[model samples]
Target: MSGAATLLLDAGNTRLKWALQQGAVRLHQGVADYADLSAWQAGLAALPAPAKAVGCNVAGPARAAALAALLAPLPIVWLQAAAEQGGLRNHYREPARLGADRWAALLGARRHHTGDTVVVMAGTAMTVDALSREGDFLGGIIVPGFRLMRAALAQGTADLGLPEGDAVDFPRSTGEAIVNGALLALTGAILQMQQRLSQRTGRTATVLLSGGDADVLAPQLQAALAVPLIAVDNLVLDGLAQLGAGDMPEQDA
Candidate 1:
């Protein structure tokens, strides 16, 4: 089994992602929507049988049970955050309460960058976590994502129906205003977190942007960043891969 591939999954609120990793190298990667278990099943069938399958799930217990059933005899272990893992310290008041996705993302970030870091994952919810120069996960903030924010506007307001709009500084139309506003709010939150990290550490933090919306937010994020900004993919999977084979301990082991 030493040389066998390990299946890595990142189960978030909106999607299920997988990576087939053998040792330090990733052999394949893919994603599927939650509504389509058949798609995930087909995708899994096409891959090499992994020696071990591990994942981090935050989509709730019922989903985890369903996914576990889907994997069947293979038996998948869902990972959760610890006070510390892969050398990244979890400083959350309740360390175990930290989302596994965020924990895995931080672990992935540790491999991606050294120095102080501001980790951003933009998906169903956008999370911006701060890491100190010494590898302390100094917690983060979560905000409604671009689509969620826009949806909230549509749901909350009578006049602003959901319409396609581009992110622009000056919005001549209402749709443009909503779209631009969401992007600005998201990008602004990232910048603010980076600045806060820099202020506290006395050294500027590198920004590692990940998740589904990395491409959507990267251009604007890069435009406003003063420090290094790396747009990484599959951070959760990277963390899971780094994790190798493990269980979500009742407490940090």
Candidate 2:
């Protein structure tokens, strides 16, 4: 597979992550949303060579089908763990029940950090999955993401509101109260998970944060969690690209 050209896409709930690469070395990387694909195409058309694409979609079949249609002329590979490739053994009760986004994140986690590592993705949904040194998928936790938490509080409770600014500290106003609480809970959950992982594994695991809200959440989480938190903004796409290249060991289908 060395000389074969490749393109990787992580069509997540909020955005599209695309990358063109030769093995592990990326040539070009771009991001877009559903409305931004036309621009993505224009950018792709400007590239120099023929390429096959590998993608992981978490927005269900409709968006996946539309994405396939958009990349019709080129070879687009939808990601799935096969008996032959796409590393990281899935230990979910039902392997197929795992979310593609989580799978992609785990793959990236395993690729980026060796030894015991905890992959914490703070996106529309917060997910923390632990992987052992030898690549075992040890299970995970999921919680409402920050925005969802804010929305839920606003809709479900009286006197709760959404904040106008990005600050996630103590607030004097209703909106700020809601936002600050959400941030506290979000960061607290991540810190607790990191502590739990450390206690259980007896190995200090690296805490990695990704997804759209990572930058906003990282500082708070870092302040609280104390362990060094590495932010790899394009984790999903990087994992997709790495898996597509057959860079890691093969796994069960």
Candidate 3:
């Protein structure tokens, strides 16, 4: 672990994120389109030979095959969702049906917080998962992300187009209205989930935000919720590191 880095990859619906970690420090990291082979190769070429390469891919099998070809000779441990992993319990009726990204992110949240935590990943699709104080995965909500929302409006409606404006309480322009509405909807969902988690757990839940839109939505969520809102980058990679450290859950038969 000290001499060689552990390569961690999180292949999401829209993008592929990677990180190389040696001990507690991250040596290198990058993001690229999941469909772009050249971009993936370029990023992989920059890293040193890893002692172990582990990944969580929710982008389907075609992308997984491409990743395998790209990382030839370096065997990868492609993680899957289990009933439990890294001290967090998966409550899905069919545990394997849970998204690998969400499972990893839940573990990531547990690694950072010992109390009730709400994991929000705002990417191509926004996911809001609640982790109890005891590290129980209480399921979550998923909705179309801001970009998707805007795109849906632009593509579905004849008069509506993608907006290029900031979020506001009352937007005068169409762009502003669309953008603000999306942001508001996202933040509103986060706040509601936080409240529900708090009520269920009897403790104020810390909101851990990640994914592409984390930075964009953090401030707004903080202003609205007035609670602890932490922005953690590459949470899935963090969970991968945990697995590399032998924190993986037992495999189901």
Candidate 4:
């Protein structure tokens, strides 16, 4: 699989991230909006012909269809409950109900870590998932995303408004207050999960941060958590790329 190539795409809620790889070596990567297929086409245009495509569409089937249309003559694989192979094992009662993004992130985390791990994806939505040391796909929790929390506060309350400030200590202004409040709440939730899960497992859980808010939230979360924290960007895409490479085309790109 060293020289064999594969094309991976992840059409998530916030963005569309794609990468072409030959085994562990990444050839190219690009990101676009959910509504932007022009960028998707441009990304695909860079890839060599005869590339095996594998994708997970967490934003639903609309973008997935557009992507499939673009990859018309090529064999495009959309990960489904029963269609794929070699990713995280789905132990959920209804595997299809599980978000594809979370599943892909755990696949990457499980491959990256050794023992019991907690994958915290802080993006359009905050998802905290646990995978056993032996690769059991334990469940996870989902909460309102950071920006969504602020937006909700602004929309729900008349007095609580969005402020126009950066994330500062104990925000004095409305914007700072909203942003800080949201960040604090998100970190607090991570800390709480760490405490609760660590007590039962005894082993210090490894916290992996992914998604958009990870850069901002990791520092605050690190301060609150008793365990260690690691930030991995585009983990879901990497995972998809890994899985796609299992059966990648034999020719060099």
Q: Pick the candidate with the highest TM-score.
A: 1
Clashes of each: 0, 2, 0, 1
lDDT of 2 by residue, 163-228 (tens): 565564558777767777778888777777777777887988788889888987888877776568
Ranking by lDDT: 1, 3, 2, 4
Which tens-of-lDDT digit does each residue in 1-253 have in candidate 4? Answer: 4566777888878788888888878888778776768776865676675467787788776777777777776767766542233544677778777787787787778667867787888988899887767666667789998888988988999887776567677688878877888888888777766665566577777888888888889778777766678888888887777667663323211
* Model 4 lDDT at residue 127: 94
Clash pairs for candidate 3: none
TM-score ranking of the models:
1, 3, 4, 2
lDDT of 3 by residue, 1-253 (tens): 4667888889888888988888888888888876576877876676787877788888888888888778877777888889977777889889998888888888877777889998999999999998999979988999999899999999999998885997677899999999888899999999999999999999999999999999889879979876778889888888888887777643311
**Each prediction's Cα lDDT score?**
0.86, 0.75, 0.85, 0.75
lDDT of 3 at 226: 65
Q: TM-score for candidate 3, please give it.
A: 0.93
Tens digit of per-residue lDDT, candidate 1, span 1-253: 3588988888888888988998877888888888898878887788888877888888888888878778877777677788977888899999989998999999888888988999999998999999997989998999999889999999998889998888787998888888889999999999999999999999988999998889989999878987768989899898888887443442211
Per-candidate TM-scores read 0.94, 0.88, 0.93, 0.88
